[model samples]
Target: MVKDLKGVLAALDAQEPGSLLGLRETQWVDAKSGPYQLADHKAVEELTKDVAAFANGGGGVIVIGIATRPDHDEEVLAHIVGVDPAAVNVDQIRKLIRQRITPAPRGVRIGWSGADGERVLFIDVPAQAVDTLFVVPAPVGKPGSPRTDTVAVPMRDGDSTYWLPRSEIQQLLSAGVRALGMPTAQALIELVRHAVSEAGPGDGPRVGQGLPDREREMRVAYEQLAEAGLGQPAGEAWAQGSAALQDLHHERDGEPGWVLCLVVGCPPVVVAVPVWQAIVEAGRHAPGQSPLAAIGLPRPPAGTDTPWVIAADSRSVDVDGGSWGAGRMTCSGRGVWRWQPLPRFSLHQGRSAEIGTSGQTPALRLRAVVNLPWAEAGRLEISKPRRTLLEQQLPHSAVAGAVTMLSMRRGADLPAARWERGPFGNSARSVGYSCTIAGSHGGPALKASVRLALPTTMESTVVACADVLIEDAETWAAALGPGWETQLGFDEVQAVLLAAWETAAELLPDVVGDVAGLSWAAPPTTELRMTCEQPADNGVLPVLDEFVDLAPLGSNDGGPRSRMAVTIIAAPAMGRAERKSLLREALVRMAREFGYVDAEVDVV
Candidate 1:
């Protein structure tokens, strides 16, 4: 479960001092009953003992990076910073433990953990029925002590605690055998033989005569039990229990060999339990990691970067007469600015944009004559073009105040026209046109018109114009029919249109506001005279047979729009009943938006 070094460090930091219950320092143990020291030829034997002891004692942590020093303060120093580089072959460690330890510990998780890039192995030993004891050949110390005279056994009592001495160990082993149904000597012999066969040709000894044979049997049994899903193998379980027992024995005797041991049995078990218990504990613990715990949260991967544009300035114009006229108002100041795109367009309305700015800047207003088809919508006839100049340095707050005031005064009335600053730092402007009309449908037909207000000093400029048409609910329903129930509705249609607009904005480099100089041209002016005649094929319809005279504005020379006349005819399909039905539905919606009620639609 400890996935990385972060987890290991967190685990260590969370532990209470001296709470490493079932671990023992190999080098610190007394010679008689201890496993091999770090410098000894039988060092593997020491590792095997602690591993088994921890397993037998009810599971514990073993950290190999730090060692206890014999200083006056009884200080613990991080000595062997990590596993020796020469010992990179973990197979050797595995072999030593597998060959020397009894009922070899099951589910033993081992790996490196340290900032120094040194190896620090960990063994998670599970508790068993009785204590597991480790037997190692005793080393004779100087003078009177004879080298290799007798075997010494070391056992773990509690975390960092160990116990030794033949008599006490024999007593513990006897008790364990008695409690767990003692195996006969013949059973041991048979087990050793089985181990030899299973270990294959390179393995040594077929009897109790070799450590490999005994270890082989223990490992086999442990594997079998683990495979059966019975709380690890008996070997590890017994080792854990034995470790705890050894700790208790060491505490009473004050023996030197049994210095590293751990005790756990009461409530609030030490160490993070397995997944099942952890789940239960999680419910009991408060949200977030405790000061003593380490935790991690998952996060989504990073996404791709997206490009965006912001509007800087804006202006609006309203023409008041049917003739050509020009008016300007000085507006200037400074302010923070942000931009947003325009909303909903039916003509593949590409990206729309809006900008907000605040500062001591100048604001300009223009008046213009707008053409409409309905006689009820009268054209403005101005007596004279009037220009008003207002000079005032407005604060940043005034801009926001102006926006609020404008919004309030509108009172749900959709804006008829608005302006925006150019994309670049240029004296460019933009205009928006909107109109609303009553329809037979539940909602009103909303239409948007647009024009780019560019500086007209430059000629031959290409400007990209975008327009959006918002269809009424009735129009959409009529167009989509019942399929609207299964497909995306009006809202989805709007979203798709907005997406297309954004795509177009990205694709088209020469956007209207992007460049400067030339202004967007309006429809050219013209004077016309014409003659009409009845169509021979369709008696009810009339067509323009010829033009009497035509003239273009700005020049007397004949232009593309001058002296043009053409006849029109309805297609046979358009005269069909089904086609007429579709046409009526479409025309009804279009006519409603154009403010034409009960008006005849003549197609020629």
Candidate 2:
């Protein structure tokens, strides 16, 4: 079933290949259409990841020359476009392992899967002992160049390849240093090599090649932190900081006035970077133009002009007199970062933040708060659309790292499940993708029922597409893991919104961009959610059972159009007007796809 990696690898892997014409990608299996491009350093790094991740986990199969379908609800394997065993360069694959991964993996076997012409390659990676973590070099500059100073620890969690978070990498190195009884300063220097990548990605570390500049940055930051006497206790530092902040005021035109200030202590600034990264991503609307610029202070690293603290010297309120970028970005996306001001109180929208960092960590508080117009409102505030955008950006940010510790006001109103200090995020994005970068990782399931319906009369082509969608929905539902037998209730609102959003993304992309520009640039946050309604009278087994891909295909040949529902009881009900509009749009879009262009949705 493992065919092409191109488009064939669409849905999740089934127990075996289905008639869907492709092998689904799953936690244990992956498919690719071509061999790794070893010439490109990034590709080589990727190849290292390809072999290492599988070896790191339960061990899995990487099938070369299989095409995959991209746009399906399930993991759809396309065709088995085999590789030439004669042309296979086994040494090249082996060479990448030596160049990148540390302590080369043991007993990785490569074999041919099919006969000639339809030949494909399969590399079986055996699981490794879990004592020490594996390391790999990171790609830099153009495709083939290697970053001498930086390396990443790649792991296969579920089906995704992820770099350990920078903090974790630091911890690992420090632990290694401790085991060897090395000095703390040397450990710190080793950690310094791993600089911040993209904002919010938790991209472990960018180790220096023992470069002097790298060591100097770490040394200076640590020295400043020591000078502040922050290592002894965070309370004292916070007290001093808060006391100093009270006297601060923004200069309006020429007059002094109250202004919001975003204060964060550095050295341990990495802790706060993710939160700030989310804010940056939420506000980012264009390239080379960042919303943070409006704040006037530098973006993160606590005091740098950019997002990296390693490359740029961090500005400090104590030293340089201002804040800066937090200096890390593992990945970038509209969803990677976010802003949501909970309803007033949670402390009534008043501003407060918890401090994080070690004495060994750097100290240099960063402060920059703008928005003079609504400065009195207190705390940061953003729209629901922005919230949605943040939810879509960091699907894999949580992988292999503990990069966030969400600190909220004590009086804030939040669900009990979220009261714990853990990764800062919600039920969207990764939950569905519950969902992560890895394929069929069986992550915690986040369920939102969606019911799709079809009218009694439609062209076979439309019916076919609709059927494919339904089957795809069912396939996705099936992938959610065991105990999914629960029946999906009707959610009219979700159905409509689902259709409308899908059609809008396809048809009016520009319009959506013009409107929700920040969110439009983000990846698709909503997954296809559909469920069929169960009959009140369960005794009767209908005649056309095989035809029904979903709960109940909308209508019979001559009966009224079938109805489907979608609902998320946990979600607060939307406004009445918006719900009605969504229903109308869903109908209109579905009808148009089914050849009803003039159809004006009136599905109140």
Candidate 3:
């Protein structure tokens, strides 16, 4: 949470004396005399060991812009500069600590020193609950003790000094291995359960009977509970209400000994009695045959008396019925039954009924048929109502009917479309027929094929309907042209241009000029340079004669449309009006080529 150099300096200034000691009783003297020195790997490792030791014993602080006096000698200040604040690499240092330490400590604060603009790393290692020990790959030796390199270091008691001990050093290296065999709360419970289960029945203390050692028995019981999925060592609380009741089992009829019993609930007398009776009867129906046996409730022998009894004093009425004897009533005595006389009738005696009327005969026998071509496409048709209704009301467009028929004919020879006709005044009232076409490359072709019989009256309604097909082929082609060309390649661009030219020639003759066969070849590299045709020279010349600098519009790499503007010198032969007109035409053509509809052109 500490912020800039000012805050860190303030915090350091507020700390108690002797707290700013460096790795080995190192103290921060005046920055002007000797600034903090950046410790090398050996120094850092030693510092970290002292830090861990300090944390394990009690919390301590390490100040970077500080030096310590050795051998009870006060420092004659030496100016050893600290690490450059701008290049401390604090994250790398933190990562090193995490990788080196076992059960890495967190919450260490690092900051910069304000006085000398140097790196100040503060490691606040809190007091660990358990003893914290670190294994150093190499040792920091005594002042003159041959420097044999100690493998591990411990924070010596009372002093902020780090000492490499000969005996306890091995213990640090083996700490991680020793941690593996230590019993976790859950593991301990499992061990106790295993011990209890191994004890023979009636051989050890009876179930719930106090063991010779109460603590040992409780430990065993706790272990058993854990084995039954009730133990949570990492501090998850057990469920209290109905779960507690369900978990508890006590002895009822067996020799004052406990056996696990799974109790569901205590229901009302009436509900319990009937269920109990049904269970008994079901068991009696098939001796020793009951499904509840899986949950430890098996059917007793047929002649065995039911041990479970519905308590007489228990509530017996059905809660849902609102009456004590409501469940006992029969359907015949209830209000649901009724009687009525049947009308004497037979299909032979009945006259032929018209679908929409009570008539003896109808003109047409109609049947409704529905066909779904694709899983998502379907059409419903009422054959009987063909003459009754002119057109079927569809959920989507009237075109849906046509779409349905076309899909039906996909990948198959076109079937004769079905239709119905109603009589008109002189001719019959004609209901138009339609079918949907589906599949690639079939819509327009089918539409063209069907449009032939538009005015002709055909006996087959289906054939007449086919003639009315309308295809949006040109629209679809125009929309897909550019995309198809882009997918195909630049060669296709010319093809697309030709196609567009032809389409425009047909659709907008006013804008397109008389056709001269289109031809194109890639322009030369010299042509890529910006040039303007000079009427006086009878040739093209670079637009800018002088050194002209260009910058991107809006300081971007390119303008809004990747466009740039250039001004050309007025030619001697061409009038200003002629030059302006030529520029306008060129700009318009370029805009069209670039697919811009609202490009602006200016003459300067």
Candidate 4:
């Protein structure tokens, strides 16, 4: 089972010693006589049926050109009647199988080998979570033999093929659903258990609070199934099998930071596997072209570009987080192909999302996770009046890092999840984003939380803040003299803030709004007035606005700490809490700048 190329080589080696006649026939293994020519329509149909059975059932290998040894009395062994390489057409056979199969199997392998002076074709069909019965249309006779092809559902019974009974078809479908659900449930249980075990002594009671109800149901179902001695190993197998997961484990297995996890349920809303896979693989390296361009998410226009601030500079956003680079690829198809990011969402305590179409859709569930280094990401935050400086830089930079991650290939929708203030409001220490990024074409999707918490590696929030301050000083020349002019234009600054505010509002619709109003007076002695354009329910501003005035200390003053006055304005009748929220929002927006703003807003 573990054998891939190694297994093939081992088979070839074993053939040298003696005939492979006595090879054991397991549920996952099958053998077929050599179909001399793929032009033999009947033979091709039979092969398609055999492969489909293996996929619908547990995964198995079909060794073609193998037949029972005539001289041997035992039924255990078979002789390799190697295929004629020249006569056998692999492409034609593959195309036939792909066209006939309802939903193509994932990870199917086709290979050829010569053993004992004979060539053989081997097809490795991987088990699929979607229970789709593969049907070959009729005309049991030759092509165009006065008979049209009739759809016939075939199932493998031991060493034979039979029409799957209607009752069994229902049962098989149910099994397929269980196959997908049970493993997911089990994996989640394992995740919660892992979280509990890893939590510090003081963090005892909150281990699984973030688990979603759907996940909880899955956990219960998985437990029940396990008790019945019927469970799925798919989730665990997928996690182990993914190259992306392996890389993440290697790079940041135990480090604490924000994690974006994707659970892509197949048949995607878009059934373009070839295109999807291309982009996913291409995204791992410097793609031949901008992968996002294929998916219609081109880089922003000039002057409107919201650059990823993670880069040391404000110039370009080039981050490659995905580990596996693309290999050679050549595609031939009818339509134009485009790339799309994998579906993904945030996963943390108290947040989760579920998305997909109804029960009618067939899907193979896949899960992937991306871990963002807290130390590096946290370095984007700022303290005092410069927090906006960091927030402003985070989106594009974080996106570049996140997009390139191999795990992101599993992320389905763009902007799957966006950040929102947490229960205690925004903090340099922690924040959470939520969204759903998984599903088959019209299938339901799942949601999860992406939390940016203080890194275990960092001593305190202050330490993370200091890291950014120091970096900002060097990067943006935050230590410039009093007479130095700010290089940021008012429009550019407004655009950046508006962009972030919009993102926040999108992620936290109930709490935040669009830029109702934005007006900034020039830099030195700058007067900035920001407030919600539309008033809340009672004709009063939902949140109050504030004006901050800062006077620089003399050049000889120690580190920069200017004289500051924070003027709090009450929206005619807005409450203290609303005023506070408004102030926090203002602070959150303004903290991204290294310069100062000093002015008060008096409502008209």
Candidate 5:
């Protein structure tokens, strides 16, 4: 709970060290064991990164000189070890914060935490506008070039910050969702436009030249003292007008870009875990050459439970394909893929073709979808009462009947989205939708696709309603599995709540303590309806009142139970290793409950 200066001080006063032990680093606050080394470029980059992440993630605090220890899956505050103030240079740190972060997150504060001269330094960042993403220097780019050294956009996820996957940047810019999430080419063009006027006659290209004209006509030498960001124009490589394309073609969703990328420092996003596993399991069609291995990712020994996350940058070297091959020739970006999670298991030639050029690696960025099923929120029509009911628990940002808030469409053709009415290709009795951002982090956002299966019987409602809620929980759990912890004002545990009541329920006080960062004295009120459908006027509208069961939502009330009557959308939360050792214990405990013998749960 040591997320603020008050908490830090309390810990210092009560215990010399470890008073705040075992406290996880929340989204709004993080602790560093020592002062930043200004002389090291990497250290300076990291310093700017920490500041940017806080600002990007709705602002928070970074406490330096606070020692921490890894406890379970999280790093907890372990000591009050202080840094020598004499060895710290507050002014330089402040300068880097300003110089490195684009637009320098508004209202940031830097100073000692307590007293006139305290042992710890606090870098406080205010929530930045999401309208524009912040950018920093990427490790690889055109060498010795100023302003053209390939800048990366850093985004904060939970308590950790990652380079905004290049694929996402394209989607945001294409959707015109934010200001700075531009395509690499457009980003470069924008940068050029922003700085060209200030350059001297011979310093760089003129404003009058078109991009192609500039690329074909200029040549300049590297400036050893050049800086990559603000106050500098495009570098010598760009000036020489070499044919390095901007490569940022903004697209909706994500693109299965031209080249196969290998992600560094992060795992590929799982668009649909089940679908992913199907493809992985399908690898048995041919042994000794797994799909993951074809992409250069390392797999654990056959029987070990270890996960094979692609966490390293293996994109720089030459790869020999087992079932695939190398074919580095084209640069037109045609075969280029932008968002295909499952690229055709084939050879990659794009990297070999660029060896002597950009020197940049195309890191793999995997992704997954987050739509929950709704019979058809966009197309279906309903009375005022039913619409209001849908609006309550599955609340959204738009006005009462907006499709974004409650998409009432037919069961089959969902989220493929035809915002306008006038389609008759297909239909289904059930439908489901998706999401990426955390719901509580920001609302009025695209949260989930609620599946409202058409036909409903007394028994099936339980499965339908529970399925959506279960997806809501599991999706969040998947989002924060390993290397994920709490974030201030964000309660990840709410996703895991199991409710028995139909109308509404208050989370038990004991459950409140399991929340992420901030604690609540009084639990919040949340409606937990086991059913979304209302019975006939003559029929008693079934409610799970203090106890008995029944369920689900939308126009249809009760019909004969068909496969169409129920739908289950689950987000795989744990890894394959989760099946180890806990199955018997779970089966033993779960079997005690009536009609629950085959319940399958993937737990760590």
Candidate 6:
């Protein structure tokens, strides 16, 4: 059973089994009366949409082989109809979803449960860490309409699934999630103190001189949050049904002035452990450390001497009629530890301006929950400096960098010299690099400073995970479609591969010799042309068109020793034996270059 299955079962139990129903269809539950044989394309498409919808929303369950009565009102229960055990093939459905959904929903749990002496399929879809909306391509055509090109954002609204509106899509696209900014009332007071201390002497009222100004500003901030419907800071007479009022009267110990509090509720986190593990494994350090390191941050040290995770507290509360949980995950190393909560910030204002100004975007509220483990690994550490250093000497410096290249042939034939003049050329090449500088931070505990060697790329784990997901086969296949072919068994592929080897051989002439005993029995045809038989109505002469034709080979596994196979179509003028000999010579030369070998030779 999935972790949330108990909750789902509880929901189902609320309705009696024989009361003309089973469980009412809600935003999170979908009841279908029959088994989905994914071999049926329509069934596959429907399943894809439902999965996408549940992933986009707060995650939900799809109960197949469950019947519902239309005559009943909102309380209608979808009773069990039972699935055909023989017809159920979990692998096929899993594969279909993997092939069709872009950035395919992670942590999708599918199982069979017995009910009413019959088996029903339960598909539990987990909400994504971020707004990773799945886009499934429309298949050929509808029953009554001709084929058309379109995209879909399947989302669940109320009790049904539909393509979400453009406005909603825009909102999801622009929505941002950060670890709740300040996790506690004390943290907020500390931040205020830090801000005031950081300000120059000429800035707004100092702590003691700006007493009235501070009070007025605090009141204004409170009113702004109240007017925006975030609720009054706990103790106001107008406050009603406020359960999260623990910090209503919270204030800095030394500062007696009034203060405004604005709290925004956030979404519950859905942890997908396997996906999280994959991301961490793909990273450079410990099992789950790379996701954080890649984004220009240091991974917390882990071992027998250090704990992998330390959570201080966790709890759920009702806010603005929505239930949101706030919890902390801390990682410590070298006498430094940082706390990151589900609703990360205890108090934060989102504005691209100075802190004291009224630049806060009250109209725009932000909220997000951090997935456990993976997100836990990404919270920034707060270092405790033991000493201070004011050295006059320059520090030793070193540059760290890495580069990865994915090279491939583009055209069907050997490049025409003319192709070089065309913009972008014919061959395709992509390069990625990660570069960082080594630096040092020195200070005492009072300065709260420590040595720092950080990456220039400072992105959240959620963003970094999304980057890593791009390399996943399911994600790439779904995004590019089945027709995406990277390898073609054309002469051009061989040419490119050989050219690279030849260049390498130049630097190691002693190691690589000329195609030792191989000789061209017949000069290979480097170019082929086809001429049209007739001219157009303009009466122009017949013209010959040069074309590059290469048969698509299979995908490259992206390993250094992976073999590259090339197919060479012999010229029509060549004899069978001659073609075979030419093929043998080419294969031998390729082997000598340690590139690609000729797999086959075909003569028309």
lDDT of each: 0.29, 0.35, 0.29, 0.34, 0.35, 0.34
Name the regions of candidate 2 deviating beyond 4 angstroms: 1-22, 71-74, 143-145, 177-183, 186-604
Question: Which residue pairs in model 6 clash with each other?
Answer: 22-77, 179-344, 180-344, 180-345, 181-344, 181-345, 182-345, 182-346, 183-346
TM-score of 6: 0.28
In candidate 6, where is summed lDDT lowest over 10 consecutive residues? 394-403
Tell me the tens digit of each residue's lDDT in model 5 across 1-604.
5555446433342222344455677777688988898887778777877787776787777778778788776777777677778889876785566556654454455545433333576665656556646666674433332253566777667657778787987786656523557776787677666556544444343321234343322212112112211122221211111222111111232321111111233221111222222222222112223333332222222353421321122221222222323211111223221111111111111211111112211111011111111211222223444433443434331111222212222111123222211111112333322232333333221232232232233211101211122223233334334343212110111121121111111111111122122111111111111221233356544222211111111112333221111111121121323321222232223222323334333321
Best by TM-score: 4
Q: What is the C-alpha RMSD of each candidate to the true structure, in Å?
A: 30.1, 27.1, 37.2, 26.5, 26.5, 32.5
Model 2 backbone overlap count = 87
Error of 3 at 251 (Å): 56
- Give candidate 2's TM-score: 0.28
| TM accuracy, model 1 | 0.28
As a whole number from 0 to 100, the lDDT of residue 451 in candidate 3 is 10
Off by over 4 Å in 6: 1-6, 10-22, 72-75, 142-150, 166-604
Using lDDT as the measure, name the better of candidate 2 and candidate 6.
Answer: 2
Error of 2 at 91 (Å): 2.1
State, as a TM-score between 0 and 1, how close model 3 is to the true structure: 0.23
| Candidate with more favorable, higher TM-score: 1 or 5 | 5
